[model samples]
Target: MSALAPAVPRRTPLDSFAGTWHLTRFMLRRDRVRLTVWTVSLLALYAYFVTALSALYPAAEDRQGRAALMEQPASIFLGGPNYGLDDYTIGAMFANEMTLWMIGLLGVMNMFEVVRNTRAEEESGRAEMVRSGAVGRHAAVAASLLTVVFANVVFALLGSALLITAGGLAVADTFALSTAIAVTGLVFAAVALVTSQLTTHGRGATGLGLAVLGFAVLVRGIGDLQAEPGEHGTWLSWLSPIAWAQQMRAYVDLRWWPLALSVVAILVLLALGAFLASKRDFDGALLTGGSGRAEAPSMLSNPLAMSWRQQRIALFWWFLGTFVMFGATGTYLGEGVEDMVDDIAGSNPEAAKMFGDDPLTGFLAIMILYAALAAAGYAIATTLRAKNEEADGRLDITLAKPVSRGRWFAAHLAVVAFGAFVLTMISGALALWAGALVNGEVELATFLKGGAAFLPAVAVFMALTAALYAWVPKITPVVWALFAFTAITGMFGPLFDLPDAVAGISPIWWVGRYPQEPIEPSHMIGLSVVAAVLLVAAFVGFRRRDITS
Candidate 1:
């Protein structure tokens, strides 16, 4: 019988996804708190925007005036194409003004979630351990993708429900916008999956994913700017998934066709990611790094220098990102400042009171606050790097050398401090430069002072993160929760008519909205003192504790 043909195994198409559902459940359990926080924060943001808009523009004329203000080049560049501007309703305004921003935020969340589960797991060696069990070759990637998809769906459903109930928005329109947001998030998750296959490290995968996101934003912005006022963007916008979400045009002649583009892109990317995964070996990457030098660099001789070397790439990306975003925003300050301020002041007295008299200064103060928030984010991430090192057993190895625990911890803190200050200053300088190019009246010194004024507040957050990492390493993530609380309070307290005692809880609030309101010395000194105390606590705690890893 032809030597009894060797029994050949029959492979089903779904064989590669054998343990996908099991792994997906495991991921859900692992990321329960993280997913909950993300979902809640996004929903709260949507609610805040809707509430603020309702209060800011009670009449059709107010909404129309806001739309006219948004017609300027800078607004269009930052916002969406000028859809529904002719007779802009509140729903239409939400669709045009908020959709792109929400999409961008969701895209970041999805990309990080995907990379954290897939590439980060592999880098930490846990993925190999899991695969050695009953898991199939593509089970981990499938599980990550599934988990992210579930999160997006939950966000879409809850967000749509909130809009319909809270804002009394049309059911159809709310669903359309929420669906766009969810689908856009899926596209980025797929992009991250493909990127994870390309790079061996989690950070590399995340950077590649963010680079694609940035490119999409740029293309969409250019396309929108190239279009005539009060019209849809040119075909270039059609190439971007972001633009696809925006072009759904919820509440403004809603079109469902654009979402088809997003769905197709997601499918293509997911397939490519799977094919690449099949081609690569476990714990391997399609894009390999170059060989290392024979000798160590001089910069590796000291702990501080080594910390700087590890963090420089992230710092560069932060600077570049802030430069482009703030510069674009600065360009809008020139001619549109007066009309924009007037619209806010005329419709919403609370907003007017917050902005103060000088429109330019008031606007710059708000922008600087945003810049400070970004700097604080950088600080928190840098601070957490120290904890990651300890958890990965690197700290134990380094400590075995002549390096002291306090010194090693302090080295990371120094990098965080330097990076925060540099990022704040760069943001302030670029905004002034870009505004001057258009307005010609922006005072560089005033903007710089505005940036500097927030440094103490930024330091407070960095120090808080360090303290958390030192004492309660397991709860270090609470710093992000604290950040979210502060962000909501500081950004929306005035609009919400929150009590002074409650608003004062945010460190940023104590700074008194610089340039709009004069910076108080007492507040700055208090914040500095708090930061110093926290740093001392971090050093003491870190020195006393045993290295866990």
Candidate 2:
């Protein structure tokens, strides 16, 4: 052992995170716009929610009445376990009604942010290049988590300040609620990290993360429905990080223990993710994908077929999710529509307006609106797949073949249009069928017409996304911003007392509330014409633009 083996230093655990700060800085720089948008949106939504709640229920009696309505299974499923309902204050209402939704939104945002930086970077070969530098094996994951945590911290601080100053909520309760929201988001970010280690594809990771979220929602909803007011939900609720956030009881009791659960979970998940990441080869996953066919099927011969093949799995997930959610809502509605309507109307007239005089039809119309929004989301995602393919250089390879750019682009749009229509129809039919199963009477045709009424709006959104993709691929994400604006306006416009001119800017607002009011043929014809123009513009722009890659 010649002087030889002067022992080389063994790597310590901290060595794995050696370049974490550098990568974190890089990630922040890369996602500055995205992170800023999420932050600002959350803050604005929180402000709006606080302001709306204060204005809508100015008195203690009003708050208590609103709390009574929240006892409904549908309300509990959408909101949270009925905490502080007996003495419901504005702060308590915010904690009970809005906490879960905010955390859920944050969960989605965190999932995408983590998956984008981790698995997506790996898929794009960027991680490999980064790791070739002085970066440690775990630096990328650490960086992603740090960046997300940083964003959450900023949100929590700003949110706490906003609640205190704007809503005049209790300082302690506001801090507790804001902290819980931030930690809950971190929990999901950790979940996404684990998922990213489980699959090679970014879509697979994102899907897995979302599936976990869906499960959490389902479990938490069911658990909350099983429990009475002022009580902790069933054990199933305890299993969800979302429930953990709510269990903090920010306004009622303000317990800090629930947050400990989330912290422990984050640690465990982060550890597991790191272990998996280290054990696998770069660009590999612990759960390796199975081998595919040695030969391409005849279906792969066309651009349209290829597009369907790429999108069918995601479409299936969407359909399944929509079915489960609406089916559950319908089943709950079966309890007593009249009573439910009376409770809702008695509590909040603004919300009651969404359901017209014919309560059942009006309720179904609102569901149809939700279904249409879901379809629009699916359409946007499907349309953006073209942009993704182009950015990844796959579209160039496909175009290098005999296929024309216009044909290839058109195939994606066709899939988007058809998929959106089917999703909307499925949501309406399933909701009606499920409701009829329990309630004993629902006309399928009425719901179908309600679904059909939104087809034009769906088409417009799809066309708009396609046009953006064709003309300015860099700004394709603006479509999502538009989608968000439309959703907020459609859902809260009535409550906010927004003017018709303001609300009319949303394409969904253009569609008549079906079953409640007859869908106007003129609205349909005009929307179709607008969609046609946008599609024409998209086709023309695609023909002229350079392939991004």
Candidate 3:
């Protein structure tokens, strides 16, 4: 026994990616609409920006502006040290400015969820019925990966085309950037594939995928920031598929080999994931069951308490995230850095004109947006807890008690509404303390001001989520759709020259864009009123409606 080694499984040639194409057509049909939209919307977002940027900033001047900004440490940490900003266009600016933040984040979430939820769900028991008939195990996962890969490639081509049309880049540069971004996604998609095989639960799989995402971001951030200004973050960028795409620098340097690295990473990850997937038994969880406790814990007193008990881990993590993201660590640079960035922005005559004498407001505006968005995130997730409970059949028994439906919905709402407030405060407090600590301001008033100002916009999300949970349960996805819409609109809408009407839909537009200190009380009150109306409608509908599940 002391000398025994673990057993290894034998694999046959048949196990190596056979019969995957059989389900390709079915997968394409099922995901065609979704992929089309996902690819189109992302492309449109970049195209719109590229067009607007082409008009707003001439290529040569844009490059000069980027070069001036690279000298600032704050700028480097936040937006990546500029890629030797020469021959830059609006499209290049859009890519350089956002490559690390928005594009990277959206890419990771979209690809990871597609792999874990669509393909891994099949691997786990959800696909068994379909597999029992005409489907093969390899076919489903292969089809899904194909769909995801195709979607990414489409996005790449669309982005490249838009950049070429708007920015008038050399054809080679446009394709290089687009291909690099797509390759980056492929690498992460492979990472998700490997993660799904190792984890039995979907949540566990998602966690692994996110872990990989976090590593990519961290590696990219460190590489980009620590590198010298105008140096392209070189070898460090090679460590991350994202950094690889970013270093392609599109219209700037247009490096190619980094992308080859991304492709290699993807192939290796896919090979490893396939080998592991072949070894595991279907529907087999990673960890086996544990014996039940001899008796119930004292914490199982009431439904409210039980719900809290079950959700404590989530709450803790949310709180920690709120704390960690207070202004974001990278954005909080030393005074020398902040001063340097301000000088750079000041050096650009256009930015100087845009700032209108006070540029710090730009930073504050971003902070408010980030905090409000985080609060909105908390509100939506908390409200959706009721829907989840109902779906799980817990609500059926809970409603069977002396409890009324309204009371049940109200209890959950109360938890969410209060939790929303708590989350907001936590976010504000974190930002306030972080700012004060770094800058020696020592102002709770600053924190409270930021928290109070964000309320109206954030409150809207809580109300809408509650309304969605109560009345139109069929459209539950709206909670997230609206949440994401708000966030994306606020961030990209301004950059891309979207209609003021559409940008106005973001509560951010109405909240005085805080810490800039406009303090438009009337606008804040108006936003709150809108939120109140939605909440009232939800309450009324829930009071009258019957439970679906």
Clashing residue pairs in all predictions, respectively, total 0, 0, 1
Judged by TM-score, which candidate is best?
1
Per-candidate RMSD, Å? 2.1, 2.6, 6.4
In the range 1-549, model 2's lDDT, one tens digit per residue, is 557657788999898778999999999998999999999999999998898788767777667767766776667886767678889999989988788778878988999999999999999999999988988888899899999999999999999999998899999889999999899989989999999999999999999998998888888988888886557888888988899889888888888899999999999999898888879888998889679889899879799999888888888888887877677666544435666565656666665665556655666667777888999999998898888888899999998999998888888888878789878888655565575467666667777877888889899999999999889888888888889888877766666668888777788888967777888899899999999999999999999989966
Instruction: Please provide, for model 3 over 234-271, each residue's C-alpha lDDT reduced to its tens digit, 9 standing for 90 to 100.
Output: 57755776776776666666677767777788789878
**What TM-score would every model get versus the actual structure?**
0.95, 0.92, 0.81
Q: Please give the lDDT score for candidate 1.
A: 0.85
**Residue pair clashes in candidate 3:** 20-139
As a whole number from 0 to 100, the lDDT of residue 150 in candidate 1 is 94
Q: Give candidate 2 regions above 4 Å deviation.
A: 1-10, 228-231, 331-335, 343-363, 436-440, 495-501
Off by over 4 Å in 3: 1-19, 59-63, 71-75, 78-81, 86-92, 109-124, 228-237, 287-357, 385-429, 432-444, 476-505, 522-526
Task: State, as a TM-score between 0 and 1, how close model 2 is to the true structure.
Answer: 0.92
Worst 10 residues of 2 by lDDT: 331-340
Instruction: Tell me the tens digit of each residue's lDDT in model 1 across 1-549.
Output: 458878889988788888999999999999999899888989998988887778777777777767876876667877768678888887888888888788888999999999999999999999989988877888889899999999999999999998998788999989999999999989999999999999989989999999899889889989989987556898887788998888887887888998898999999999999899889998899999788798888778799999998899888878877887788777756554666766666666666665667655676677788888889888998889888788888889999989888888888899889999988888655554575467556667777888888899999999999998888899998888878877877665666677888777778988877777888999999999999999999899888878886
Q: How accurate is candidate 2 locally (lDDT)?
A: 0.84
